[model samples]
Target: MNEFTLTADFGMTASDNGFIQYGIHPGDTIMFKKAEDFPVNGSIVAVIIDDGPITLKRISFYGDSLDCYLEGGSSRVAPIFISHAEYGRLKVLGVAVSVIHSLAPAEE
Candidate 1:
């Protein structure tokens, strides 16, 4: 059998309630690292929101927008709006490039 590895380039170093305010799925595993340490684009990340937390699909339009699609059986929510100030507050916890499901095959 082949071994699978899911690599995250950026993440948070410490546990911040602000970061976890967003709902985490029952089996979801989050990898924490620094947000700015990475290239800053084309990465899937968790964004902190006023109402809750969200996982961004990617950094769109030169960091002006955030794209996030639903995972697993979750339904799709509207795209998150990030203001310039808000964008600055976003700490890249890591770029989630791939996911390894417990019951399913690894996705990259």
Candidate 2:
């Protein structure tokens, strides 16, 4: 079998309280790929926006709105609303495949 290694454009800083159950934390490096590689309304993906800051959320398309929200980690958090205009610069950056964790203890 041929192994495909997709090159990542950048990494996101995940929050500890957000994805601790998934073993992802604030210092962890989450690799990403070009948006073209993944499907829209797919699973958890890292989205880069030109008008707003980059986000790590589950993406779902509803007409012109891309519904982005916390999937398994929280209930109180609200979903982000992005219209088609925002998607003009939208890039999936691929789905989160794995995380490079920062195992060092908290700083003093």
Winning model by lDDT: 2
Global Cα RMSD, each model: 8.7, 4.7
Residues 20-95, candidate 1: write the lDDT tens digits.
Answer: 3344333345564445554355445655545455544444434344432222222343444455555554544455
Q: TM-scores of the models, in the given order?
A: 0.43, 0.59
Clashing pairs in 2: none
State the local distance difference test value for candidate 1: 0.44
lDDT of 2 by residue, 74-95 (tens): 5556666666555566666677
Off by over 4 Å in 1: 1-33, 54-56, 62-75, 104-108
